[model samples]
Target: MPQDDPWDAEASQHVARNPGRPKAGFYGAVPEDDEDGRHPSSDEDEEEEFEEIEVVPVRPKLSVAIGGFAALLAVAVALGAQTTGPDARLSYAIVLFGVQLLGLLAWTMALHPPAAGATAAIVALTALAADYLAVTGEPARFLPLIWVALGGFVAAMIGQFIRAEDRQRARDSWRSTLLIVLGAVAYAILLVLVRQPLGAQTILVCCTGAGLALLVARLTDAVFPKPRIAAQVPRGATGVVLGAMLGTLACAMLGSYLVLPFTPAKGAVLGLVAAVAANLIDLAVNFGEAGRRLAGEAPTFWLARHMQGPLGGLALTAAAAYALTHLYLS
Candidate 1:
């Protein structure tokens, strides 16, 4: 074995003796950011690190419960269309109007826009007016829905300035108001659909498909969120594809109970179209949530936040139902 270098020991002793001296690499000594290894919130130090995570993490129990709620909502609308006999349109309008109110409430809370109270009131009253006009006036005329939407939009924008917190924010409220107004108007489309021949059956099948799709998608997300659609969004690609297929199958099964001009094949078609439309709208909600999160805004309560997607989906599906009935049955 070789003997130790006495010069190395002497050098070490010299370095230890002159602790104030800087090392070869720099002009002065460098101190660690955190001697205890704590990291800053920004993770800027060598000792700190953080990876991007989902803005909205998935919760299994919550997802399942939301799924069930979406299904019940669909079922309620279905019953309104099917059970009222000669007054089916009126019944459907009433039921759907209630659903629209719920949606507006949730949406207003989620956005919390300037003049939010007045915005909600304007949208709700617009919905009421549209519903009354649809049910009382000419059943075949569709003009009332348009006029109500336009008038409601103008009122919503003007109402923004009534008690403005900030002029810019008040201006921003207009877009949100437009969404609620359009959604309420969309519900009135159902009244027209119900008044059409065989329209009740169309609502049953399409609503079944939409509701079941949302339910199945939510439950599936609870169980398996693998192949995640986006890192920021907690939805699963598996759930979306499987939900749509199951919704189609369910609609097909429902076709047998339908009267003339509908078959299993036609029901499947309606389910496909309606389910796609509903799921797309639902997915858009998640995307909006992602955007808001990225903008550093905190979300509202989980239950209230999650529900508007499904309700919005069902609201728009009414339009799809009308179109499909005309295509397949007319």
Candidate 2:
């Protein structure tokens, strides 16, 4: 004997009553309405369901705890660097990198997930150990690492303010791009200017080079927009790198001709490193964003977003600047 279809009875009943409507089961069927012309369940049910969902509040206490730990670590590194002799340039570089890393971590944790704050703290300590193993020297000779540390915190706060304003204003794409470029230029200038007692000529050369690089990058972005086929690569990455290379080369040649203390070869080297670092930073940011969006609320997601993206970029840029000032200067 063959089994009967279970939907047959209901289908026949509805089909006979509503001849114009299609048969109902899974698809192409409208819900049956009563004499009042309303479904059995109304929108009120959905509203109540939505109302029951709870919103999690952000906990500032966690951010504060993590930031405090980072501050202590930074103080320890700074004190260690100060106690070291003047010849330990490598030690100074490591300390500078640590301070920069801590400052960036603090900023990211304060803004992003509170739990990821611990991850940022751990990374800072790990970096310190890695740097110690990688390079050994007496201490920084030219620039003060302490200023770079302080500058990190200041930059973070300023960045947070700008970011909030941008979101509130709903800035368009072009305006957003312009703001980011300008911010980068401002940061570069700040880094250079923070080195007190710098000669007028030194300041002029450094600022000009940094500013020109940024301008060239911005112009290049306008002229040669990323191609559709280049979707695999982050937008503006190629243009920014190319512009930084060209601008840095131009500045290096000019600096050499102007009889700047650093050799032309050193200038070219610094420009090349800066270009590479900029590209890497862009890639890291793109990758981090994509990872976060795909992974949702996972701890790994927050870790990548907070630690690997912005903080990584800032560290590379700081390292490049330190090398340029300390290694090249007479």
RMSD to truth, every model: 8.0, 16.1
Badly placed stretches (over 4 Å) of model 1 are: 1-51, 54-56, 88-91, 163-166
Write one digit per residue (lDDT tens) for candidate 1, span 64-96.
Answer: 987898899999988887775655566667787
For residues 163-257, what per-residue lDDT tens digits would candidate 2 score against the true structure?
Answer: 55443433233232222222222223222323223322343344334334444443444455454113332235445666567746855775686
Error of 1 at 68 (Å): 0.3
Worst 10 residues of 2 by lDDT: 177-186
- Candidate 1: residue 144 Cα off by (Å): 1.5
TM-score of each: 0.80, 0.37
Q: TM-score winner among the candidates?
A: 1
